[model samples]
Structures are given as structure tokens and as C-alpha cells.
Target: MATNQEEVKLFGVVGSAFVHGVQIALKLKGIEYEFVEEDLANKSDLLLKFNPVYKKVPVFVHNEKPISESNVILEYIDETWKQNPILPSDPYQKALVRFWSKFIQDKIVASFSKAVRAFNDEKEREKNIAEASEALKILENELKEKFFGGEEIGCVDIAAVFVAFTIPLIQEVAGFEFFTAGKFPKLYKWSKEFLNHSIVKEIVPAREPTLVYFKARYELLVSASK
Candidate 1:
């Protein structure tokens, strides 16, 4: 557990799914921290200084030390807090967890983003959607339990925050179906289980505003693609 003298702060934007993962990990660990909301249009000096390389949201600061990347921050929190541990203790299990987390970030998220960006081109959009669906199928096969970490939520579950929440929202905004219950039943069920968890419910952005935000952003992307 963190001491009273220890200070923790999260630098992120409200709508970022990557940022949400860090927030969920902090809450799960029962850590008390200040949330500094950043405006991406007008980046904050602290965020830039802390994450000079990416200059991105979701920079986690602990006792004046800054940590960039959501997955790295999640591991750090699990190691530091020790209570309600996010990653497994067994070496093999821990390695598996890390593997799935990286797969989600590199494979699943990347394909989904490409599909979303291929908005104006029909052939390109369908090709990207097929690629994204293929990636999701692999995840569906990997999920044999209620959550990615078996009965309990773990690092991989937190890593998939974007898949559970944001992808569905993007599907809604874009008027397409990539992560549907019919196509990927296991993944669909897992999404429900993950989203309905009390901690996740607390941190997820409200539906209406989040949809509106995505809709506006999607329009801009489509306009740019023209």
C-alpha cells in the first residue's frame, strides 16, 4: 500500500481508453491519487516534460517520478501496491499475461484503428475490418474463462479496456459492426463481463457524451480522408 507521504498523479484526457486502463489499475489497487485532465489540443507542460518522447496523455507520476505507457504503468502499480495484484505471481502465468497484453495493443488496437481510418475508401475499409476481425478471432479463442486472467481481472483485462469499451463505441459511431456478439461470442461475453465490473463502470466515460465525441472525431477523419 502507498504511504501518506507518497504522491501519485495521472496525466490524461477523459476520452482516452489508454488512460482509462491506468485509472482502473490505480482504483483496483486502492491507491489515492490526483487526476490531472489534459487538453490534447493544448498540451500541458507537465505532460510534455514527463513524457518527452510521446508527449501523450496517460503519463503516471509517482513520488515525482514519471512513467509513460499504460502497460508499463500497470505493471509498476502491481509491483508497488501488492494489494489486489494485477499480474500473476507465477512466472509462466505472468509471461502469458504480458504476451496477451502486447497482442491486444499491437495487433487488436492497431487493426481497429486502421479500419476506422479507412473510412472513405470502401475496399480499404472492408479489408481493414477483415484484418481487425481476424485479430479479434484469435482473442476469442484465447478466452476460456470469464476474464482474460481467469476468474479475476488482471493486467491483460486492463490492457483490453479499449476492446471492451472504445471499439464498441467506435462501431456505433461509424455505423459498422466489427466486434459483434454474433461474430465473436466469447469476446463479446468477455466485453460485457469486463465493462460491468464495478471498477470499470466507475471510470468509463458516460455513453451519450462519449458517443458525441467519437462522432465528431470520426467526421473529421472522414473529411480528411476525402
Candidate 2:
């Protein structure tokens, strides 16, 4: 294969924050690629084949080789494209950026999931939501200027995107609030701007389908906890 733009393919799961985050990065870099939607429930052969170890979506295929993990794929896309750079070139800045991204992935994302999973248990759910909000406040104060990337979208912004795009829908389904204008003014404002960012605006998954999927999933989890 000659390896034109179309040769770059991404295996994605619908309504997935990780998948959507990578897609947002690709669009930011002005990269053209095919997006293959994977049914995570059924576990597609293509996904399993490309990401055998994790057996997950968000496998970026370039020249027939697959890159697993959204953040790793994001850096790969930035390095390969060399336009609209995602990570800061300065070593210290780059390290700082990576630290925030890692924080989002390891700490924030898991908190959101735990909070959602505890929907049926009000006390557990409230505690988790409070912890998540405290964690978010760190990001809120970190936004000294326009984005996590300063004036442009960057790696940290991409990594913490779930807080901007998905949490509202999760709030709707779980009947709890974390990212709110009252509680996190800066983060709430960032969410609005993030959703309206030229590339991000276009790629946010449809609100209806996302709400439907999350609502159904939440119901299943809640029922199971009973």
C-alpha cells in the first residue's frame, strides 16, 4: 500500500470518550483518516485482531501496523503529522502536560466511572462526586488562560475532554452533578469553549445517542447492584 491519508484508519467505539478524544486530536492535526465504529458489546474481530492484548477500540492503523491506547495514538498522530502540534516542544512543558493528561486518565476518569456506578447508592455516589469535583478544581485553577494548551487545543485538553463533553450526559443519566457552573465556573466555561472549538464542535457525538447509551448502561449497572 502506498500509504495515502485514507490508509490511516482508526477503530473506534461509539460514544466512547477515548475514541472521541483521539478523533478530536486527529481533526486538530488536520489528518484525514477512516473511522471504523466497533461494537464493544460484540467485540469485533478487527478490534480484537488489532488490539489483541487489550481487545479494545481506538486502534489506530497506519501502514498496516496498529497503535493501541488513545493517548499513545494521540502522540503518534502528532509526531507523524507535524502540524498543529499536540504536545509542547519544550521538555519541561511537555512533561507538565503529560502529567496533567496522566492525572486525567488515572484519577479523574476512574472517579467519574465509580461515581456513575454508585448511582443507586446515594452516599457512595455523593462521596465519589465530591472527590471528582475536588480533583476537577485542580484543573480549573490550572487553566490560567484560555485552554489547557493556552490558546490552542493540546494533549491535556484532549485527555481531560470527557469532563467537558461526556459528564453532562452522565449527570443526566446518573441524576448527579459534578461539572456545574456553580461548582466549577472555570471548568464549566472551559467545557462550553471546548465544545465550541472549531474541530471539537464538529466531532462531538450526537447528544441523543450518547444519552441513550449512557442511560441504558447506567440502568443495567444500577439493576445489577441491587
Candidate 3:
């Protein structure tokens, strides 16, 4: 990776797991780049031009060619840098990694988000709790080693970073016991190690402000439900 010739920049918002994934990848690869924070409330012209289809945050621009979607950006970074390889070299293992990564996005995130918002509705809360628990159990079984991709924090770990980062906040706001160690031991242990990772610790936002924001959002959702 030639640093001097190429210009690298990241467009993202704070408190977004998707953006965090890209940032973490950049740090893992030891890639020096500029970060442009986008205000989602007021969509930026540059963000729109780069990601017109989704009109969303987390657009990774490498030499003025922007890559949309966090997973795509992760793949690009791994392929381009070739230093701290995130994905596995073996074809079958790589496929499995992608499967688990997509599973985190598709199966886990929806239920987790629902569980957070269901704080106001007892029945809905329980339903999402059960769903989330089941999903987490599957992940627990998959993480036979230290991380999703063995001992090293790899691409699958990057995909599931939200679980390590935001789940505790949701647990606090919902007053739920979903992520208890007594329940999902492996998943809980993985989360602790994931958060404790040197590079990962650097990217997490301060808990106080994150709590303030999530608390307000929880109250708003509760009120709207009523």
C-alpha cells in the first residue's frame, strides 16, 4: 500500500456501527486517512454525490473512488492493503466468514433493534427478547474460539462489532437481562475480549454521551408508543 501517492478519506457519522466497522478496518490495516463526519439530520452534498443510491453515511473514498456500504469497504480495505489480513485465505473458511457476517447484519441486528425499541411494550419486548436470545445462542455456538474468526479479530468480528459495542447500552435502556453472562456465556466472553482489544478500545465513543443520547431516544419511543 503506497501511502504518499494515494489519498484516502472516510465519510461517516459518529455512533454508527457501520461507520465504526470501516474505521476499525482502517486502524487494523494501519492506514492513514482523513475522516469526514456527516450530519445525517442535514444530508451533505458530498455524501449524496458519493452514495446517491442509499444516501447514507459510511462512504469510504480511496483516491476519489468512493465505496458504498460498510462490508464492501471492508473487503476493499483487506484486498488493497494485504497487511493485517482480515478475511481468511482459505476459500471455504472465507465463505463461512461471509455467512456469519451477513447473519449478524440480517438476523441479529433486527431483533436487537426491536428489543431496544420494545421497552414500552411488554409483549413485544418479550417477543424480541426471545428472538434475540435465539440469535445470540447461534453466535455463541459459532464462536468456538476466542473470536468469530479464531484468535485474531478478523472480518466477522468487525461485522459483529455492534454486538460488542451497543448491546450493553440497549440492555441498560431496556432494563433487560438479554446479555447476561449466566445466559449467553460464550457470547458474553467474546464481547469482553472484543471490547478489550487494543484497537477496538480506541474506536468506541465515550459511554456518557452515548447513554444520554440512547436514553433520550428510549424516552421518545416510549412516549410515542403511548
lDDT of each: 0.91, 0.84, 0.86
Model 2: residues >4 Å from true position, as ranges? 1-6
Inter-residue clash pairs, candidate 2: none
**Model 1, 1-226: lDDT tens per residue?**
5689999999998889999999999999999999999999899889899999999979999999999999999999999989999999999999999998999988899888987887667898888788888888998899989998889888999999999989999999888878888999889999999999999999998988999999998998788778
RMSD per model, one decimal: 1.1, 2.0, 1.7
lDDT tens digits, residue span 1-226, model 3? 4479999999998788889988898898899899999988798999999999999979999999999988888989999999989999899998888888888887788888887776557898788778878888998898888988788899999998888888888688768777878998888889999888999889978888988888887888888878
CA displacement after TM-score superposition, residue 221 of candidate 2 (Å): 2.4
Each prediction's number of clashing residue pairs? 0, 0, 0
- Rank by lDDT (best first): 1, 3, 2
- Predicted model with the maximum TM-score: 1
Estimate the TM-score of every prediction: 0.97, 0.93, 0.93
Candidate 2 residue-pair clash tally: 0
Error of 1 at 128 (Å): 1.7
Q: Order candidates by TM-score, high to low.
A: 1, 2, 3
The TM-score, computed over Cα atoms with residue i paired to residue i, of candidate 2 is 0.93
The most accurate candidate by lDDT is 1
* Stretches of candidate 3 exceeding 4 Å from the true structure: 224-226
Q: Predicted candidate 2: what Cα RMSD to the true structure?
A: 2.0
